[model samples]
Target: MSEPLVSIRSANLFTPNGTRIWKDLNWDLFPSEIHALIGESGSGKTTLAYSLFGLLGESWKYDFLHWDVLGYDLSYWSGPFGEELRGRSIFLVPQNPNLAFHPYRKIKDQVIDFFRLGLRSSEDPKEILELWKEMGITRPEEKWNSYANGLSGGEKQRICLSLALLGDYRILVLDEPTTGLDANTEKWVLRAIRKKSEEGKLGVIFISHDLRIVESMASRITIMKEGSAIESFPVKDRKIEPTTEYGKELEKARRFFL
Candidate 1:
């Protein structure tokens, strides 16, 4: 069996006020697999994503017995190694796509700067255009020169994903990628993500409350509730049958709407 891209055991996260929010969470992600984190709002799914890269800053506290990602020990994730990990090994797509860009900066300039500064590689304009095309962006040349504010939410989301792909990342953490998108837009966005994951270049950590999307995209699933990963299983033949009560309840809720 291949080694997991990410692994955690006996992990806990506390709020700034020292209130325990996440407890005894254990999870694993493998390369070329889409592992979905499904739960309700305030379930600490987003916090788990943020904590992976130490984005919570020094205020929040984490107690992890074993935390490893991309072959590095992230038990103390706020140090120099953590700085090296962000945008390099793991790229997080925020719930709000607007947070990924500056409204005033041209998309073309920002992309070029990223390749130059972040990767230290000479970026080909054609490569950028091609990447956007793969993300379902129409008329990449025209949109390239446009400001972030000019793009629609779906477009910005795709743009953020394209930028992340350009980085040297092994894992992509998306917090609700299809949220607020029209049905058609959501379809293409999901298609693009699926295509990328199927390419087997990296692993994806897809965090969403939408079980339908999770069932459609993820090869493995982890059910989280009240800050704990209560159950984890492979999505055999695209079917999810949870063994835990909370997980069964979530599946029941999903089926009720269907």
Candidate 2:
């Protein structure tokens, strides 16, 4: 509604072998909204996410790329502009949180580094500690001093979430944020995400294979298959009984979940 915070048009991405993973993508992400990129494995959801942040693997590249995020052409990121864009415009919470941290560094040090890199504000440390408490990390102070290797998978995920939040970028791209969390932790993280969306400080692109979670969290859903978007619509008005193939797939997925 308010001039899409992120816009992509006729974008195509290719693999190292010159295989096209995704092509002719046209979409827009607006401020204060949550958009879900839904698909099964190999559907190119994560690939698109990486492309949006200009982090696509060396083997892959885009054609006719035009990404304007927060009024800047992120698709052409290079040099100083790239550094500035990385810190200010987009923040990514990768799928594997365990890989995001430095094994030798304390959690607090990593958090501080995030701030020092201009990805977060100076007040991030204190705010993150508060979020850590909210995420059910007991003795938050002690946890802050702990190394990445010492924390459990769920704990690591929460730490990543905190880092993303602390950065406070204009847009946050979460790639399967609930991948390894237990049911309770999943709910907790979901609650925190809902709160973040409500605050209206950032737009979110939630990528997940869990259709149920996407149905519940995303305002709009893009159903992708074979590395391309086959359908896009408002989740609330999905109408499970539709006759289209994509709608039928949604129905089948819903039934499987139920």
Candidate 3:
């Protein structure tokens, strides 16, 4: 109904050496909608996420027919608007949480830096603790003063989530949000994401290799293969019946996870 929060048309992305990574991408995400991009590893899911935030590596090149977000063409953003867009319009929750945090800084200080740079507001330790609690981080106050290098993988992931939430972003790109967590921690992380989405008109592009999780969280799902989107379907479209090749593979994956 309202203007689509983000739109991509005829988008083609390539890595250096002229290896095509993603081609002919066309999609629209509305405000508050959760769109899932599912595929096997190396299917360009992360590449798409990086490109959206203008974080594509130097080796990669893209032609964005119409890549617009919040009424601006992202490809054309420069100067202060580019800086503003990074924190205000779109945020990325990286797959590897360890890559996001600095080992030398206290975690709380890192959060404070995020708030100062992105939010242009002072950090509220109380608010940060509250979000840590909501994300199921244990000993929030104690952990706040510790360095990221000291936290476990799951703990680091939660901290990464807190950093993203500390900013005011309309859209969040979650790249394999549950990759390294144990089952229990995975559930906790997923619950936190659900809670965050509930409170804001947030558009999310949730990327995952696990179809079951994608089916659970996504309103619309796109299946990618070999750097291209091979199928796009609603999660409720049907269950894996094992009657087709891809369907058979999907069934096998489900059974393996089970």
lDDT of each: 0.81, 0.76, 0.73
Error in Å for residue 23 of model 2: 2.0
Candidate 3: residue 190 lDDT (0-100)? 70
Give the poorly placed runs of model 1, Cα more than 4 Å off. Answer: 118-122, 130-139, 165-167, 180-185, 255-258
RMSD of each: 2.5, 2.5, 3.0
Which is the winner by lDDT between candidate 2 and candidate 3?
A: 2
lDDT, residue 21, candidate 2: 83
In model 3, state the lDDT of residue 26: 79
TM-score against truth, every candidate: 0.88, 0.89, 0.85
Candidate 3: C-alpha lDDT: 0.73
Q: Which is superior by lDDT, 1 or 2? A: 1
Candidate 3: the clashing residue pairs are none
Per-residue alpha-carbon lDDT of model 1 for 1-258, expressed as tens digits? 689988999998898999898898898989888999987777888888778777888888888899888777764467876776564567777899988888888998987876765543578889879877866789999999999988988888887777655666678899888765667767766777777776846789999877888888888988878899988899987788899988888998985432
Rate residue 146 of model 1 by lDDT.
Answer: 98
lDDT of model 3 at residue 95? 85
Could you give candidate 2's per-residue lDDT for residues 1-258 as a string of tens digits? Answer: 578887888878788889998878887787777888876778888887777756764567677557676676754563357667777677788899888899999988887887877775575557777888887787888889999988888788888887776666778899889876778777877777777776855788999777777777887777778877877777665332334587577658764632
- Superposed Cα deviation of residue 186, candidate 3 (Å): 3.3
Q: What is candidate 1's TM-score against the reference?
A: 0.88
